[model samples]
Structures are given as C-alpha cells and as structure tokens.
Target: MLNIADVLHRWCRAARPFALATVVDVTGSTPLPIGTSVAVDEDGNAVGSISGGCVEGAVYELCRQVLRDGGAPQRAWFGYSDDDAFAVGLTCGGELDVLVQRIDPIRHPHLTFAFAEVADGRPVGVAQVVDGPEDVVGAMLSIVDDRVHGNAGSGPSSRAVADQAHALLRSGRTARVAIGGQADDCPQSLTVLVHVHAARPRLLIFGAVDFAASLSQVGHFLGYRVTVCDARPVFATAVPYADEVVVDWPHRYLEHTEVDDRTAMCVLTHDAKFDIPLLRLALDLPVGYVGAMGSRRTHQERLRLLTEAGLTQDRLMRLRSPIGLDLGARTPEETAVSITAEIIAHTNLGTGLPLSSTSGPIHRPAVREGAVMK
Candidate 1:
C-alpha cells in the first residue's frame, strides 16, 4: 500500500513476497482512514498500521494466513461485539472491512510499478478488484497521469474501471467503485477499490524562525512536503525539519513555485515589509490555508496595508491572521500544535470545540460525497 510504499519497494526489489491488509471500508467512528494498510513479510515481520493499536493482532494473523495460503486474497470484517467481550474487534464501536492480499513481482507486476511510482513522489491510483468474478478477483491496474498499466480484468471492464480510477486519482481520494453489468462486453458486476496515492501536499512556511522550525516538524508528521523560505540566508540555512529550505524573498519564491488547493501557506514573518507583499500574493492564490502569525494590533495594521494594496474584502476574509487556535500556548511546540490543528479543522470542516461537548458523530462526512470509504 502507499502508506508503506518505501518499505514495500525495498521488499519488492529483493523479490520478497508479502501480504498486505488494507482498510477498504468503514462504518461509524473508525480510528484510521481508508487506504491505511499493514504489510507482513514472508518472515512475519510487519510494517505500518490500521486502527492504531486496536484490532492489529487480528489483522496481523490475517496477513500471515494470506501469505501462507499462497497469495489467496481474503476479506475480513471487524466490529465491536457486545455479545462477546473477548471477540477480535474494534473497541471504538466502528466496523472495518479489510482486504488482505499477497503481493510479489511475479503475479502482481502492477503493484511493483505502483510502489515505485509512489516512492518517486508521483501521483498514482491503484484499482483492485476486491469482489467480483473468480478469475478477476484480486486483479489490479495502476493509473498514472491517465496511462493505465496492467489489467483489472477483460479489455472492456479494465478500461471502464480505469476511467473511473482516473477521476478519483485527480480528486485525491480513496473509494470503492461499483461497476454493474451495463458496459459492453462486461456482464459481471464488480467492486473495485481505488486507492489514490497523490503526491504529498505542500506546507510552505514563509519564515525560518523557531516557530517555523517547530511547525515544519509537525507538517512532516502530518505527511506534508514542508519548505521553509525566507529572504535572510542566516535564518534559512539551519531549518533542519523542513524537507526543502529556500533562501529568497518569501513573495518572490512563492510566485515562482507551484501550488494547489491542498497547499497550506504560513506567514510567520510578522514584519510589515515581509508580510505585506507575501500575504497580498498568498491570500489571492487558491491555497487551502493561508495563516499569518501576529498580535491583534499587528493584524489590524497588516489588514490596513493590504486594503490599501487593493485586496478585496473577500480576499482579506480568507487570511487567518493572528493564526492558530486559542490554545493558551506559550512554547513553540505547543504553538505549532495549535496552528496545525486550525489548519486541519479548516480543511475538514470541524468546529474547533471539545469533542466531549459535541453530541453528534465525532468524524465528519467526507468533503466530497463518496470521496472517502464509508
């Protein structure tokens, strides 16, 4: 799976076989998201996780069974059991449907290519036949930039599935797609699990200060490609946590770089000279998050300057000046937590409130319907 692509690539390069158990579907409050996977090598060594700590032992045994069965794929269901406390299930009362399948270069050449694509930071979608006809079950195809490698089934069905997989890949979502017997030359209905491995989103931190360093670490932990950019070379040289460090004017660097809706830009440089031009560009861009660090008075002054720079009120509303939630944070680490929390909340449509006070489902629905496995 893409979650452990690096490890899988190593095993694959060595011609080692492994069984991978991936979370394909979920109902209710699950601990892990869809596409989360755990892989077990031929020697029973495991990597990655699904469900944090709960239900791992059961999944591990399932992986071992798949490996021993000569790569036969299996489906497993885990849910909370009130009737039997000792049952192997999730304690959080959520139901998980996992698909355990074996992978090797011989039978699954597409997977080896998919793993390599993921390792190289390329966007790819792997579509596997989770449930279908006998011969087609466990068949897979990898789609990269509209080009599909390998086969899911027959010619017509594979093309149909690849078309749908391409759409999901563009959206950067993992989902289960159902194809009925409507297509030409395809009579059997099939369920395809399209696992999207989009390239890591950018977390552009525009100041190499201490807070930026701490935030860069958090960004990496969140699976982002972090870059620390500042005009001052002295401050930018030693940001150890960032994936890339750029010593250039923040606004200039941002203008020449690529960004998308998933990119998050943080303006930690509170000085007017740096904040004005950089924010004027950042807020206008269609980035996911644009937060600036400053005090109330500083925020007011920055807003006044931006307003004079001809930024519309709607554009100004997109800026999260005086960034981060009200966490009463003092240390840089705590502040980083607060800022990343705000970014997640904004992206996920979460209310920044205590879960204990909320009475509804803890996990919100996917931003796009059917974008996530549920």
Candidate 2:
C-alpha cells in the first residue's frame, strides 16, 4: 500500500528508465480493478500488484523489455482457458487484461503532480494506457487541476481522448475507452485508459451513539475515511475517531462537505431535529448511498416530516430507512453488520437472495473474460 507520494518520490529518485503495468480492465472473477498498477524498476522490483501474483511475473518480463527498447505500447490479455490459455492466465479461473508501458518520467512532470494530489487527499486522475506504445503501455494519463498532462504524444486525437479521460475522472471510474474512430473501427481497438484517482469513501456518522461507533469502526475497516461528526463536543472528541473526528453540527457539516457519487452518508442521529436537515442535504446531492436508522414507525414519522418539507416520493425512495437488510439483527454489533452488508449490497447491486438460488456468474462479469470490452 504505497502512498502516491511515496510512489512519486521513488520514481523521482530512480536514475534508470522503467516500465509500469496497470490493470486497466479486468473481467470475470479477476483479482484487481481498472486502476490497479505495479511499478517495475529495471532490477525487476515491483511496488504494487495487478493480479494478486497471477500475472505479475509475465508483466514484469514485458516491462523489462519496454525498459530495454522504447517500443510502442501493447495490450496483454490473460485468462484461465483450458484450450487457448496464455502463459499469464489466472490460475483461479479468472481473466485479466493488463496494459503495460515504458514511461519517461522526466518528460511527464504532471504524473508527479497527479500522484501528489492523491497523496494529499485531493481528487486527481491517472490516465492508464489502454492502447498506446509498448514503451508507454498501460501507463496512466496523469490529470491534475482539471487538465490532462500525460498523453504519450500530443495530438488532436490524444486531446480528445484526454477530455474523455477527464470526464471519467470526475465520475471516479477506471476503465479503457474507444474514441475518435469511425463506426467501422473495432470497438476494442481504440486506445485510451481513463483512470480516475478519487477520494476514498467517506463515512459521516451523525450520531455519537455506540451503534455509530461500531458503524464507524466497520466503515474504517472497509477503507472508508470515517468521520464521526456530532454536536456533542465530549462525544465527538478525538478519543473515538482519533485522527478523523469532526465536532460540528451535522447539517452544517453536510452543507460544507462535498458529497459525490463516491460518498456514503449515514444519518444515525435517529432524531428528527438533527437528522432532517442532514438527510435533506444528502437527498439533494448525488451521493451513492444514504442510510437512516429507525424502526418501521420511526421511518413512517420521518417520512411524514420529509413530505411536509416538500421532499418528493422519488427522493424519499432513495432513503434506506431502518438502515440495513432484514437479518433479524437485534444487537448493536449485529445491526452494524446488517447495515454494512446493506451498504455493500447496494454498492455492488447485489440481489440479497441466497447465492444458492442464483444459477449464473458469481462475481461481476466486468472483472472476467473480457466482458467489459464487449
């Protein structure tokens, strides 16, 4: 888990040239996501992992050649196929498509800036090489301060791809795109990897109750930047949250904080006075998940209040009141599990039905067998 700053610092100090490999796209039970990257030094040192050790060895060899010869970038596809299997295929019966590139770090000052912004908790993006020269293969496009920095080569086509990459950055998606080509062109032939570096999930707990504490802990475990915001100064102190506590009015905090599709706001306040305004703010934003804790009657009351406040049925439908899924959870810990499970299910668009009832794919197809490319 090398921080972006540390990655940049190490890259800056390296005197020799090296190639970087990134998992710009994965399919069918693959090990990594679109932005997963690994930096390979000339000596065969690897910083990050793209496929949980599945494809690193093969990618390292590709990187070594890129370092030796500044060649055009190439896309490498690996999958577990009993018939047409490549040497780099996943052993766990998954598929991964990796883009590998040799980058001239000296020429790309903006790459440093992009990683720095990520390290400092600012929103930036990396343009992963989806289609490009082997030397600059799978290398990400570095976007900082609303401008594209690394294009491998600057052209109108490159700029057009960069614009799309920037848009993807705003949406917090990491994937490849085909652009600026005729309709007859192959869909997968287009070259661009748009990888956005977004802020980690933010968990804003409105209440300082014990349930809120357990939820915050769970949120932290799930890689969220947990912030326990409460009006109670004593309860919202650094003891519970340590480095991530916020002592403020929940409504005011929601007003000032940036809530995007990557954000998850939980209204555990369970009090109409404190919860209403905050919930209203969340409903107005494009936040991914909004959860409110209460019983069935409590939710009905809150709905009445929200309707009185002119909240529409469409917006009200977005609220997951009574919080988590129905696991008959009674204790706070069980309730926390239920709530987090609901959040994960919502995030992944999971059906909540037993897997035993399902007959098809286990994981998302986008992660396996090049389905996303189609």
Best-fitting candidate, scored by TM-score: 1
Model 1 clashes, total count? 0
For model 1, how does the per-residue alpha-carbon lDDT over 97-156 read when each residue is reduced to its tens digit? 898988877777767778898999899999888888877877889997678999888888
lDDT of 2 by residue, 204-238 (tens): 77787778777877778876787778888987766
Please give the clash total of every predicted structure, in order.
0, 16
The CA lDDT of each predicted structure is: 0.86, 0.70
TM-score of 2: 0.81
Candidate 2: Cα lDDT at 331: 83
Worst 10 residues of 1 by lDDT: 365-374
| Native-referenced Cα lDDT, model 1 | 0.86
